[model samples]
Target: DQVMIISESDVKSLLTLQDAIHLTEKAYSELNAAQSMIFPAVREEIKEYQGIFGIKSSYLIAKKYIGLKAGGFWLGNAAKGKMNHQSTMMLFDAESGEPLCALSANYLTAVRTGAAGAVAAKSLARKDSKIIGIIGAGTQARTQLEGLLATFPVEQVLIYGKTEGKEELLAKEIIEKGYSAAICPSPQELAGQSDIIVTTTPSYAPVLHTSWVKDGAHINAIGSDTRGKRELVIDRKPDKMVCDLWVQSSIMGEFQHGITREELYAEIGEIVNNNKKGRENEGEITLFDSTGLSVQDLEVASFVYEAFKSKFV
Candidate 1:
């Protein structure tokens, strides 16, 4: 049997934010339906490297596949003209335990990650949400915008970044993408104007304060994947909050740093499957504490692999 190796270019060509969002939603629904399983994620801090190494593995029962993606952040690679993220996914046949395909997973990781935010926003955010506020004007900031556009008819986007020079750069990219976009001077301004807010920065201290977030706004806390990293400060409790995984979110996510299990309403999967209610009232603050998930990577990888096989064979 010939092993199929998928490149980043091939994956990017085959995958779109819309497809990723749709597939990821299905993945969450399957997870909530007990048709999928994600093993506990492993994240280790590489002190000398000043980054993180992680492993996410999962089993998709209905899809009859098992897979794992191993990679991590190398913070300085971008300056050296390499991707900061190095990830590869290996998919195996569930019954035979045979390797089926190997794929470059960095782009897969990004789109799937963005789709989780879209899933949360669609499941929990108010239906009338029109403005998207982005914190941390990086690749994630753009990806989040792409994902949201697929889910919501977003009218405008406001970007807030910690870095000085990158502000105009991200805003330009957003506008060039044919969206009404501009740079906001502060996170406070962005949050105040936005009906949906997404934070995508690696900051130790709180970049978003509860006071800045307007009532009835939805926030996706994306950056605080590891312990001690936080983007949003919970000075005032949100009305409803959910995470991808309760165990990981409680210990390694932003919840562990400032909030507790008692504060979170439910997992996003639970909300997606209608196991629990999402956004009972429009006038309440909603939050999704996303630490990212192995199932997400597995779902996208599996979808891409199937497509590759169909096209090639």
Candidate 2:
């Protein structure tokens, strides 16, 4: 077995935003078709090592681009029960059962998550959106910025974070990437200036208020992947709402409190495939409630696996 361990740099060299978006859409479509099994039994808590360990795992096995991809993760206390950590894994193979590859999922997850948000922004955000407001200055925030810049012509970006040093550091890095980025004094200031706002924090309470959002703005809430991790107010509703998966979003995504499964206007995949219109009106406030789907991981992994195979063999 020739195990090819591709680094993040190697993956970046081989795949572009267009490639990632296409693969993500294809993965979501396949997942939507097989909705029955895609909705797995989510276990929030599990027993491990004769002790209680909190585990949030969702099983998703899908067929995409002539290969099978399985998505799962385990989150619990690590480091002698002093720290909290999560690990995600992906398994990929062709239909013939030939094991293709496995990857360290942190970067893969970040890229796919960012790509999915980009897809949502492409469909739901206004065409004239030039200013971006970002909350959280971490690894996920960087990818979100990269993905958004790849799809939209953002002119300025305002970032807010709890850590002042980290915020300034990220702002400098983002500015170095050729965008006008700065650390904002408050989330309100960030929200007021940006036409497109993306919140990538793990805040339990709302970090963004509805009153601060302007008309026709699009918001991508990327941090609220697990239950109780939301960044927007539950009482605040947007004019249009899109999600990666309705079933998953309602249960674990940011939409868990504000909207039900049936209330979602459209899935991002549907919008990407042109089955539904995104940003129909100019004054519409659109929200892309991202729960982070497994299909995205599967698609991106499959793409990388195929690229590695084609070049190596």
lDDT, candidate 2, 138-256, per-residue tens: 76788888888888888888989996687888888878988888778999888888889999876778899866888889999888766667898844578778888777788778878
Candidate 1 lDDT trough over 10 residues, lowest sum: 137-146
lDDT tens per residue, model 1, 1-313: 8778999999998898888988888888888788999887888988887778988899999788999999877777767877777899999999999999999998898898898898899878888888999988766776787888878878889988867767788878778878898889888888889999999887788899877888899999988877777887887788887898888888778888756678778988788888899988879998898888888888899989988989876
**lDDT by candidate, in order shown:** 0.86, 0.71
Residue ranges of candidate 2 with Cα displaced over 4 Å: 1-9, 33-88, 92-98
lDDT score, residue 257, model 1?
Answer: 76
Worst 10 residues of 2 by lDDT: 50-59
lDDT of 2 at 31: 61
TM-score of each: 0.95, 0.83
- What TM-score does candidate 2 reach? 0.83
RMSD of each: 1.5, 4.3
How accurate locally is residue 66 in candidate 1, as Cα lDDT from 0 to 100?
95
